[model samples]
Target: MRTHFCGELNKKNLDQDVTLCGWVNRRRDHGGVIFLDIRDKKGLAQVVINPETIDTFKLAETIRNEFVLKITGKVIARDNEMINNKISTGEIEVLANHIEILNASKPIPFQLDSMETSEEVRLKYRYLDLRREEMQKRLRLRSKVTHFMRDFMDKNDFLDIETPFLTKATPEGARDYLVPSRTHEGGFFALPQSPQLFKQLLMMSGFERYYQIVKCFRDEDLRADRQPEFTQLDVETSFMNEDEITSLMENMIRGLFKDLGDIDLPNEFPTITYHNAIKLYGVDRPDMRIPLQMVDVNEIMEKVEFKVFSGPANSENGRVAALKVPGGASISRKQIDDYTKFVSIYGAKGLAYIKINDDGPSSPIIKFLGDEVTQKVIDLTGAKTGDIIFFGADKSKIVNEALGSLREKLGNDLKLFNKEWAPIWVVDFPMFDEADDGTFNAIHHPFTAPSVSTEALLDNPGKSLSRAYDLVINGSEVGGGSIRIHQSDMQKTVLKLLGIGDEEAREKFGFLLDALDYGCPPHGGIAFGLDRLVMTLSKTESIRDVIAFPKTQTAACLLTDAPSSVSKSQLKELNIKVTLPTKN
Candidate 1:
């Protein structure tokens, strides 16, 4: 209980008596005079306890870092020489008449401001870690982000509606986290991967515009940007086409950036088709900031005698492509080997290159290509004197993955970004990808509407495109959505193409199918990954930094020691039995 925040006092409050309660950030001593820095969410303020107040001085002397304290003092101006220009309260100090230690603290395991602390230790002591100023600022910004989202949605007549967290499991791409039923034996409810179906159902239910800031779960392998559980800004609307929906969503994002970070994103984000994005940049979500692009050398290499390039170039599913890195001829042999190893992780067999030197082209494979063919490659790629052309020759999948990833890595490693913020819309994605066994899988989801009729789609499913679109910022997909197939027959047709039999579809998605029959309107919506958006805005590398309680890379919660066993009696009531895989 204090009259004023410790950091709020400045020279204007000089001679004003105040009661400030906070933790002792630091304790200092000059001769016999004792000084303590009191800190709270606002910031820090220095408190001076002189021997003139004997009891307060004695109490202040015992204070240590993180010691919670309540101070009764007078705000006084600091001497000009004693002024600290770094902090807001620097122009003044609190002359304490009384000091009360609200709580004492043991020595902290790590300093809050230290950068050298391991992420494991920080996560283990997440409560203490969150007390750091940087953590406080980030969480505050997160609150502001949600506030702005809600306000914008409300202004646009979007209803804040909720969907079930414990629901039936449907095929959404990843494994779902299931909750065992106690009342019903052998029954389980899966956590929602997203509110995709429910949101669409809402449109059918006549709630034209619906939105929810919701939690979703997936039992999947973890990465820097992924988590076992994450948040999504789920939205759905009725009677809006793809163009109308994208325009509105773009405005929301543009306003968010300009309002929150004072960063002005483009009014109309550049658009790229899925086919061109893959062919030119090797990835659908291309970082336009990177100037590098993949060049197709299939025709040029197909005639060459070198089997390494000619072999893949001649195959139907194979590709021969080159990435021309400007001024990359200066890279050393060891660095080139390192890049080759990097691409190998993406199933690339090897990386080949031809460096354009001032004297002419040079490479180990130049002898294989011959002088005539080598010159053709140089001319085809428009290779300059100082440039290096890195080639990928393999199945199209491997080539795209290897070269796409390498493009991003080189962009960062070589500082080749052409702009700071590059947002683009990747559209016209193929409706389905055919497996080796000839079965089809939906590229986005089965519910996504195809651009062609059901019969047309069935005729050539591989070439059919979806109305789906994704919003990408700096190569990270922030949001994605597509027009929905409101017709029940169309929905079932797409499901059929995905190898889902009628009985299986009825068992899993009967509710959605049944709802679609009841006069559903033309509708579509987008879901933004809230954690990824904040991570991008805050310029943090990992989603964990933005989350309050995040699991480790292995998806274990260090703080709670979660995924622990329950009592035997509790398991018996749930009718569950434990099973463990034998170690090799």
Candidate 2:
């Protein structure tokens, strides 16, 4: 149907005749000559129909944007004045001798080039939206990233294996997307939140190295970076330790970005333990690009007359920490008040601060504090004349979370980041956490292996540490995995600690527990969100931009008007009832 892609026609084909079939990007009539900017997946080419080709000229005059046209023309050099230096094939234009209008299109709802177009309108007409050059390029890059991942994994002897989508749901992390069993009455199968369990079972079955680019579903609230259904680059291997897995995965990503060429990421990503991350940055996943770190001032604040600082300083489950913002005295009262409100979202009762004026300790709270206490705080935090100190005090959780979040906010607000890439491994996480009910829950899941020295079951559970590790890229958790409990006793112990008694554990995860009993090897794997990965690589804020068709915030497909009401007859066939009135 065509001689070549539109973007492929260049200086080499200046005198060659060719047939180009594409959508008319635009049609311009100047004097008696018509110029059609024809576009296909590869890109665009200009086709000129002169007055000499009367029929072709007449047909070209009727063409509009998005009109599918077949054109046969001879490639010729464009006039120097007419040359478009911006385009790759700007030196040449095809002089059309014949034209065939294959299809006519209606006017688009909105122009593709306009930045002001609303997201709702774009999502509703997503097929047309995907035709835009930017979107086309993103999809192409996504394909390339996946291809690179597969090639890397295969070269490392990882088998591309698949797991079941409809499997029994266990309490892992998120709510499962439940699918009603139509063939089996009243039963349900839940969509996998991940292939976490199955991949571990694969190790027991003796598939040492495994990988899969698989779809996963979670029933959760939506956000810019989240979707109800998403893809993951799942990888797992047997008998390999954390160091080995980290090295392999890092090399894979390094090679991937090398092919990308725009940004050169670090070869060695730093390692931060869970405890150190909290102590230094107040967050488990710290953005290394940011220079600011949290400084403890609990001992210094203990003797202060200011009850606000002193009360929390000496109490259990309380903290006195400060963030020393470099050159922060320039911030206004309005901005400080705004930041105070920001931290309140994380349960921070108040945000205390001291602006380091030439006079020193200049803050509303400073008047209530003793001189010794003020000197200790300044000394402890190494507060300088140009720095501003922000403090948080309360429960340990509130102190760390609020201050941690504020650190990230200030980095963006103050533009204090280095603007370079920083990736790291967050390791040595606690195996169990005490829930609000005073019961223990697995921090990363029950199957995770306890560190060698901490593997004692039913005794010293509090001191246990998991072999889990998270791959953090610029403060975002990209992927996570842990060595699995190959022993059934350890698996049972972890489950019992999670408050899932034998009966319940057997009901929900009997198959997995059974697999562990039958000679399971120690295996671990990581799963990266493909959509989020592609978005990060493309430097896009919204994951929806990279997805071909994405649901709205409420998880409704605008293009198809999905989650619509089903007919009563169909509902009866499934032995279901629609009790509530239909929402219009």
Candidate 3:
């Protein structure tokens, strides 16, 4: 229907006839001459209609924004003052010889380029929202990213494989999105949380290397970086150790940035143990861009008379840590209170601080600690004049969560980032995390191999570490993987340590255990959250912006009005019944 895209016309095509088809971006009538900004996937180009062409000029006068049209015109150089330097085809305009109104649109609910539109309204009209230039560019970049990943994987001899979307549910950290089955009454099929099991099976099936850009679903609370369903670049390989697998994946990611965004990552991403990451930065995925770090002050605080600090310092599960913020001595009382409130959301009782003034140290808690202990803390934390040491004294988990998050907030609020991009590998994660009741849960997954022998892991489950590693960029975990337990005994042992009894393990993952008996290869793999990766590459704050169609934080689709009710007959066919809680 068109010879050239609206954006493809330029001075190089001057005097050449062209036909363009697109939506009318804007229509303006200046005296007798009419101007129509036509837009298509390529981009925008201005079309001019002279009064001498009375029919076409009359039609152009009636056009409005979003009116689909086809224009036959001759590309011409724009007048020196008329050139739009901001756009690609800015140097030229199309002189319209004919205009065809293909379709007309009703007045749109919101302007395509308006920044003030609420996300709810934009989501409701997502088709229109995707037409915006920014949205178009983001989606285009996302396509290019996926394409580059596929090309890279193919070059590495990884076969693109498919995994079943409808499969039996296995424990994968999150609750699965179950699909009711009609063939088997009262039975359900769960959407794959990941192809973790099937991909392993693929390796045992002798594919050796497999990759898939797959969809995964989780019935969980949503956040800016999370969704009900998301895509991941899933990969698995045989006969590769942790180092080889991580090196290859790092090359893929480093090359992705270099090729797609022209951003160069380091030759080797720095690595840290999970314990050190939490101890220093308070989060395993530390934003190395932020220079702030948490210092252990438990030993110093243990001797202080202040029970608030000393109590946690002396307890086994408790911690006393301080974060030194440069030039924060001038922070006002109100700002400190605000910060206290911020940390409180993470279970902190309050945010204590010792401000190192030019005169000397000062704080409300100074009198309780006395001069000797206060000076020791300042010395220990290296809090010089003009620095403020924020303290978190509580259970270790709460302290880490509160202080770690506070460090990130302080970095952004103070503009303290030292670099634009920081990529790091966090490894040596604890195989299991102990629950409050002393029960254990796998840190990664039950299938992840332990760094120690099966007997050692079983003997000291609390201290056992996994072969797992995570790829974190700018404090966001973009990918994670671990070597698999190829032996059935080791897999069962890890599951047993996680408190999954033999019967439950057999019921849930018997297929995997049975497959392991039949020559499972020594393998490892990684799954990169495609949405989060794209969000980082595009420098967007939310993954929703990068996704084509995304649900709200409540997991409702405003556009489709999904999660709607089904008829009683349909429920009966699936042998299901609805029950509602009685209102009090």
lDDT per residue for candidate 1 within 1-584, as digits (tens), equals: 99998778888899999999998888889999988999998899999999999888877778899999989989998999999999999999999999888899999999988999999999999999999988888888888889999999999999999899999999988899999999989999999999999999999999999999999998998999999999989999999998999999999999999999999998799999999999999999999999998989899888888898999999999999999999999999999999999999999999999999999888999988899878888888888999999999999999999999999999999999999999999999999999999999889888999999989988999899999999999999999999999999999999998999899999999999999888999999999999999998998889999999999999899999987999999999999999989999
Tens-place lDDT per residue, model 2, 302-402, is 88788888888999878989999989988999999999999999999999898888877688887787677777778878889978999999888899999
- Where model 1 places Cα greater than 4 Å from the true spot, the runs are none
Ranking by TM-score: 3, 1, 2
Per-prediction TM-score to the true structure, in the order listed: 0.98, 0.95, 0.98
What lDDT would each prediction earn against the true structure? 0.93, 0.87, 0.94
Q: lDDT tens string, model 3, 29-125?
A: 8887888999999999999999888888878888899999999989999999998989999999999989998999999999998989999999999
What local lDDT does model 3 show for residue 381? 81
Q: Stretches of candidate 2 above 4 Å error? A: 358-361, 452-457, 581-584
Better of 1 and 3 by TM-score: 3
Worst 10 residues of 3 by lDDT: 492-501
lDDT of 2 at 402: 95
